[model samples]
Target: MSAKYNHWHKSRHSDPNGDCVEVAKGSGGTIGVRDSKAGTPDIVLELSRTEWAHLLTRLRNV
Candidate 1:
């Protein structure tokens, strides 16, 4: 599962010591998303590049 993404990084606005989300570049034009807090189950969500951009846009508008 770890091999699915190259590298994972949280957003710049993320709290360093609190629950955070991480994203990584996946194979092809995919994006990988997961939670980085301790004790959280290792779950990953894969999205296409277009879907990722759309999600970001919607988030920014909220």
Candidate 2:
């Protein structure tokens, strides 16, 4: 993913030891997710807004 995201935030329920995911809003309304413990230059998973919403819904139901 591009390095142009203005902000990236960790989940409010993230583990205190830093094992969690970070998410950011990117260009063209895409969402980016990456491993918080992976350090910089990690692989980012990009998803469309619809995909993100669907994922959250599925996760909540789980």
Candidate 3:
């Protein structure tokens, strides 16, 4: 199944009204993220598999 089904949502750190970034797990195993306010060609950020793992680990302890 496409890993996009497992979304990588952005944190609600400061934004209270849900105006935050966008994140999703791509089928290619990398983590896909973008600015929710971006338009046209979205500024997508792709994280490596290893990078994604480390990020999750760090966030888990935060």
Candidate 4:
């Protein structure tokens, strides 16, 4: 996820009702997560590359 990640990516599991989280890659190896249902001016949860990987692993195990 780089320049192509400039746009938010919602999961395939996202429902029509818009209940999902979106992920995007930011500069300096930072990752951004935000609510898909959050219209505009939403708060983004920022994570480092390592943190992002850990989160994915934890989620996958869940």
lDDT of 3 by residue, 1-62 (tens): 32442555776663776567767778787777676667632467788789878987998999
lDDT string for model 2 (1-62, tens) is 65445488989889999788888988768898988677774678889899999999999999
TM-score of 4: 0.77
Instruction: List the candidate numbers ranked by TM-score, top first.
Output: 2, 1, 4, 3
lDDT of 1 by residue, 3-34 (tens): 36877888787886867888998776688888
* True-structure RMSD for candidate 2: 1.7
What overall lDDT, based on C-alpha atoms, would model 3 receive against the true structure? Answer: 0.69
Candidate 2 backbone collisions, by pair = none
Candidate 1 RMSD to the correct structure: 2.5
lDDT of 4: 0.78
Q: Would you give me the overall lDDT of model 1?
A: 0.80
* lDDT per residue as tens, model 4, 4-62: 34678888878888789888888667888888667753577888899999999999999
Better of 1 and 3 by lDDT: 1
- Report lDDT (Cα) of residue 60, candidate 4: 95
lDDT of 4 at 22: 89
Per-model C-alpha lDDT, please?
A: 0.80, 0.83, 0.69, 0.78
Q: Among these predicted structures, which one has the highest lDDT?
A: 2
